[model samples]
Target: MWTIGLGFVAVLVIYFTYWLNKWSNPRCNGVLPPGSMGLPLIGETLQLIVPSYSLDLHPFIKKRAQRYGPIFRTSVAGRPIVISVDPEFNHYIVKQEGKLVELWYMDSFSSLFSMEGESRTTALGVIHKYVRSIILDHFGTEPLKEKLLPQIEVFVSKTLETWSTQSSVEVKHAASIMVFDFSTKSIMFSYDAEKSPMKLSEKLINVAGGFMSFPLNIPGFAYHKSLKDQKEALTMLRKIVKEKMNSPGKHEDMLDQAINNMNKEKFLSEDFLIRWVFGISFATFEAISTALSLALKLIADNPAVLQELTAERKAILKARKNRNSILTWEEYKSMTFTLQVINEVFRIANVSPGLLPKALKDVKFKGYTIPSGWTIMIANSVLQLNSNTYKDPLAFNPWRWKDLDPSVLSKNFMPFGGGIRQCAGAEYTKTFMAIFVHVLVTKYRWTRLKGGNIARSPLLGFTDGLHIRITKKSS
Candidate 1:
């Protein structure tokens, strides 16, 4: 009887080993990146999803990259995810010919943007290409030179006029409002300071960071509140779009341009128009606001750098001989210090830590296999902070760009991202930053508050609402 029991146990152990070997081995083209899926169903979810898990994923990813080399598989939210750090592999995933990547946490945006129409899943590649072209054409460098900069100056003048009456103010919230106004004016062409229902939109974006990690959207939960806010924001956006469409000439904004230029065969549906407006508007608002806040905070912390930038702007303005004149693309490009400042801000602040790229088929690298249907995150945070790429990565040094070769700088710097789906608003963003910085530094003198540590919260924008006392600088 004992021998019989031992024999049964031996057979069971052999079967288990065989099953484990089959499950662990790379299959389906056998070229997938190497890494473990761990246990079934709940792989790596615990490690990646903890609430206090650092948003700066460098330490974790760097260790993994060192351990597994370049490509490695792990689980995130019960889904197998591959992480690639090799620049070549990254280029392939981001730019080279391959399958289109899906936004894994798309529900987060759907909740925030209230995207509740036909799934974009089926037509993602087509939609991505079309939207990219539209944004690049309208919000590109030339368009900003002709249209956006003038609008930005007007907004800044108006915002400063209102702030001049107040003794002391929070620049972060004000910056957010500035970005919101800019986005609305640039995209929708009309905005009422008191009438626009943007609080819901703000709330939805705030909570969007929390979705996909928690199953809290089941009513009475924080995620549920986020969903509600998202719906409300969407309703507001829809109303605004419909009104603008029906009213015709109430305002001449991006919406007007889009309506005029939209291909009937491509963006035919009003629903698509609404989504485009909302998506672009939200992304622009968040990125610009955060960037501006970081720039301001850095300026306050490093007054010497700020003075240097101001001097350069003064030189540029002197050469142009018109403070009131709008800057052309050529003129804007001439201010290299302004570009350096913006680049430095992006490096230190590092907003939108990374991007998730999905696998189309099993791909191999460094003897590892990343199976298809898995998600991978190219961690920009790690790349930006990598010691090998940038000297003193944490230092807010704008002069770092002065001596660097342009070609080398381009490879190392990826604030807006890289590849085919890189930021459509890259040029517009740089131009906006230049104008904003030029205006603010030339006009205002700001002092950091006592005991304030600008480095404590570096996620871009005023997570704490930058409260600075400002005085008009004497001419």
Candidate 2:
């Protein structure tokens, strides 16, 4: 009996050792970058998700980059992942979309979109380009100068007016709802809580951080609630799409653009169209709202930056013949400092920390090989937070961008991402944030009331909500 028990214990030890070796070793033809894969199935997932108190990049990426260098290997949630903080490599990877690599989202992130069936793999590349082209037609630079700019300005002004009247407001929650209301119009139709009973925005609020969370669909987890919230939002979105299809009028939003092209484009099927609209709406809302919220917190905390920002906005308004007149393309263009502020905010905010692209085949970079079926996280946030590039990397200093132009989308500072697959809404996001800061500084003043804590569950957000009491400036 003693001999049998000892033999069983020895077998268990051997099994554990064997599995540990497999997890640590990369299954590749060539050498792999150095980094720990952590425990077997879990594989550093908990460490990756563990929040860092600082506003800088997550400690998981930072410490690994420090110890293992810019490009490192690790397994995240049972998936082998190569994290690249090297700008040159990230640029190469993103540009290689459809060739050496392809667009990839984790199960948790992809589940939120609910775009299953044929749209999953082969058609993904084509669908991405198709949606990008149409969205550009409606929300691109030309559209901004002609129409969307004024629309955004009006919506922001009216929305802030409403906010100023309230006692205290959560910047993130209020901005999410307001931005959702505004962007959803361009995607489908107008969203008015009073006019429509659908709680799509509210559902989406729950969907925010859940996309980047671990792909656990079990109850009592954020991933589960996120998927549930996404389903609810999709149902309402589909209902709206069907109703729109029944109508003869052209709304001129993204849905109308898609519907008009259904015959011209085979990929714009009803299913894909619905999912695409949901995606665009979320992109526009999330990117702008998160940045806007973060910008306010930074500006509020840094009085000098706030003073300069206020001066820039005041100067823009002063140059106008009528202060009440709508902001012009030329005036928007002249907002050099304001644009710098936006860039700096994005750099610090790290709104979109992780950009995942999967390896299509064995690809060699430097001395290491990235095996096919592995995911590469362009940990741009890690790169952005590098002290070598930006002085006082963690501090909010828009003036640092004085010599460096923020307008040029480079590998070094891509809050909206970079390369061919860079966010199609890049221009739209910058425009929205620029105008948002302009309106914020010139028209109103705000005080932080409560809840300023922040975190990144792989998605950066105000953990307790950035609550602030905003009021209109006195005449």
Tell me how candidate 2 scores on lDDT.
Answer: 0.80
Q: Write the per-residue lDDT of candidate 1 for residues 263-315, one digit (tens) a residue.
A: 45353356667666766766776677667777877777787987788888788
- Least lDDT summed over 10 consecutive residues: which range in candidate 1? 450-459
Which numbered prediction scores highest in TM-score against the true structure? 2
RMSD of each: 5.7, 3.5
Clash pairs of candidate 2? none
lDDT of each: 0.66, 0.80
> What does the lDDT come to for candidate 1?
0.66
Give each model a TM-score.
0.79, 0.90
Write out the backbone clash pairs for model 1: 31-363, 31-364, 32-368, 32-369, 32-370, 33-368, 33-369, 33-370, 34-368, 34-369
